[model samples]
Each structure stands twice: as structure tokens, then as C-alpha cells.
Target: MRIVIVGTGNVATVLGRLIIAKGHDLVHIVGRTPEHTVPLAKEFNCSWSGFSELHVINADLIIIAISDNALLDSASTFHTNPVPVVHTAGSVSMDVLKNVSSHYGVFYPLQSLRREMMQIPEIPFLIDGNTPEMIALLENFSSTLSPFTEHAGDDQRLRLHAAAVIVSNFTNHLYALGE
Candidate 1:
């Protein structure tokens, strides 16, 4: 599958490398700064471009692995051509992609992502898609890396992410305080 990855942050880098290593073609790597994506593009052997250049590429899937706040804004810049687009966001609902494109969904990895390490963690993917076909495709795609694939609606995914924040984020804060 030809994959287009938006954002060259930790999650984007990790996911791009993993998908490339899995023998999938990463067609385009989009980022705000050239410096952020150039190295990743070189590593993945993909074209490096900005968010505006999203429409220029031909890909089977466009995965937006950007920041939580930037997801919607970045998605708005994309010119949708009925291509399957998925955002890697745990807290945000799939509805955010509704206006962006008809073939939109969430491809969230339920784990803390860091790029330095090559080993992608065994994290379940809470997936949601616009159609049955996309849902199945996302489910099968998630299954490639992790065994657990759950079908979650927008509200359900949001609530689950909230709980994760309390358990993972806040708990880590407390642990740091204790230390």
C-alpha cells in the first residue's frame, strides 16, 4: 500500500519507519519544517513535502500522525479525493474527519509513542471508519502490528482516551512528583 504520513514528530517517525520496514511504500512525508521531515524522508526513502502538498501525491492511505491540536487544522488543508485517510489520535473523535473527507477514520495506537527505539510497542488500535470497507481495512491494518483491534465509536474512543490520560498521563505525573 502506498502510505502518506503527515507530521514528522515522534509518532510519525516511528510509524513511518515501521510501515516502511514492513515493506509498505511510504509515498509522501509531510511536515511543517523541512528539517523535521527531511531526515525521516531520507530514512524511509519517501518524498518530503509540506501539509499543502498532500494532494499532489497518489497514495492508498493518508495517515495523519500529527499533534492533537493540529489534527483538524492540518486535515483541513488536505484536498480529499475519496482516498482512505486516517488520523492517529487517541482522544479525538472520528467525526473530526467527517467534514474533511468521506473516506476518513481513526488509526490510533493505544500506547505512548517514542521514536528513538525501533521496537513498536504492542498497543491495541481503537479504530473507526466511515464505511464498512474502511473499518475492515483499518482493523486488518491494526492487526498487523498488534493483536488487539477494537471497534470504537467517537464518544467511546473519547472516553477511553480520557481514562488513559488519568491512568497514564496523570499517574506518570504523580510518580514523577514522588521521585
Candidate 2:
């Protein structure tokens, strides 16, 4: 599958690495900053460009792996048709991408993502899509990396993310204080 990864942060970088390792071609890497995007594109031997240059990209899927704050804006920038847009944000809903593209979905990895983490954990995916066909497609793609692929609605995903922050983030902080 030909994919275009949007964003330069840790989540995007890590996911891009996983996609490339899966033997899929990462045709284009889009980001506002060259420093962040170029190295990742170079790592996969692909071209990197800004979000505005996305129309030229020929991809089956476009993964918007950016921060929660920039997720909606970033997703809105992509043109609809040809490639489906999937955002890797647990807190954000599938509806965020639906407004901009007919083919939209959510691919939230149910795990704390760190770029420094050497091994890819058995990360489960909480996926949701605009249509039944889109949902099935996301499920198949997610199943390649995880044994489990769950169907989560917008509210369900947001609540789950809140609980995760409490469990993962707060607990980690308390552990650090104890240390």
C-alpha cells in the first residue's frame, strides 16, 4: 500500500517506521518543518513536503499522526477522494475527519507511544470509520499490527483516552515521585 504520513512528531515518526517495516511504500511525508519531516522521509527513502503540496501525492491512505491540538486543522487541509484520511488520536473523534473527507476514519493505538521505544509493542487499535466498507478496511489494516481491532465510537474513544491518561500519565508521575 502507498501511504502518506502527515506530521513530524513522535507518533507520526513511530507509525511511519512501522508502516515502512511492514513493506508498504511511504510515498510522501508532509510537515510544516523540514527539520522534523526530512529526516523521517530520508529514513524511508521518500519525499517530504508541506500539507499544501498533498494533491500531488498518490497514496492509498493518508495518516494524520499529528498532535490533538492540530488534528482537526491538519485533517481539514487534505483533499477528499483517492485516499482515505485516518487520524491516530484517541481523544479526537472520527467525525473530525469526516467533515473534510468522504473517506475518513480513526486509527487510535491503545498504548502510550514513545519514539525512543525500540520495540513495537502489541498495540491494539480502536478504529471507527464513516462507512461499513471504510470500517472493514481500517480493521484489516489494524489487524496487521495487532491481534485485536475494536470498534469504538467517538464518545467511547474520548472516555477511554481520559481513563488512559489517568492510568498511564498520572500513575507514571506518581511512580516518578516515589522514586
lDDT tens per residue, model 1, 1-179? 88999888888988887787777888889999988889888988878898777777788888999988998666677776678888999877777777667788999877778888777766778999989998988987777767888999888888888888789978889999999
lDDT of 2 by residue, 1-179 (tens): 88888888888877878887777788889998888888888887899998889767778888888889898666667775657888999988888876666889999987888888668777878999999988988988877767878999989998888898889988889999999
Which portions of model 1 show Cα errors greater than 4 Å?
Answer: none
Model 1 RMSD in Å is: 1.5
TM values, all candidates: 0.92, 0.94
**Candidate 2 weakest ten by summed lDDT:** 73-82
Q: Where does candidate 2 stray beyond 4 Å?
A: none
Candidate with top TM-score is 2
lDDT of 1 at 93: 75
Over all chains combined, what TM-score does candidate 2 have? 0.94
Evaluate all candidate structures by whole-model CA lDDT and list the values in order. 0.83, 0.84
Candidate 2: Cα lDDT at 35: 84
